[model samples]
Target: MLNAVEFQAKIQNGLIQIPDEYKQEFGEGDDIKVIVLVQKKSFPKKDIIDELTENPVQVNSVLSREEIYSR
Candidate 1:
């Protein structure tokens, strides 16, 4: 049987430190699977729209409002 444990940890020096509470479940030479998940920083939609409106991008080919809506 396989057991699953979930805990939150921070990575330091390219290594993940397991909590002491769950350490007893494993011993030396034990093989385990690891999966890493990273959270992305998100900016507010209004802020992003405001920034874009303040400084628009320069494009060679400009699309009309109808052309944009047709897609």
Candidate 2:
């Protein structure tokens, strides 16, 4: 059987301390697993021009007199 308990705590000295209430569910010699999720501080902003420039074909280069007439 498996049981799951979720809670948030601050890590100190690279260690996370489990609360006392849930600790009693496990015996002294029992093995346990832990997972940690770190919150990202911020996301980088992208400019519209920067995104368009990444394309292989530039609109300016393809904008010729013949190309415009053919359209």
Candidate maximizing TM-score: 1
**Model 2's TM-score against the true structure:** 0.52
Highest lDDT model number: 1
Which regions of candidate 1 are displaced past 4 Å? Answer: 42-71
Estimate, for each residue in 22-63, the C-alpha lDDT of model 2 and write its tens digit. Answer: 778878877777788887678777688777778645455557
Stretches of model 2 off by over 4 angstroms after superposition:
44-71
Superposed Cα deviation of residue 61, candidate 2 (Å): 14
C-alpha RMSD for every candidate:
8.1, 6.4
Report every candidate's CA lDDT: 0.86, 0.79
What lDDT does candidate 1 reach at residue 3? 75
Candidate 2 global lDDT: 0.79
C-alpha positional error of residue 50 in candidate 2 after TM-score superposition, expressed in Å: 6.3
How large an RMSD does model 1 have?
8.1
TM-score of each: 0.57, 0.52
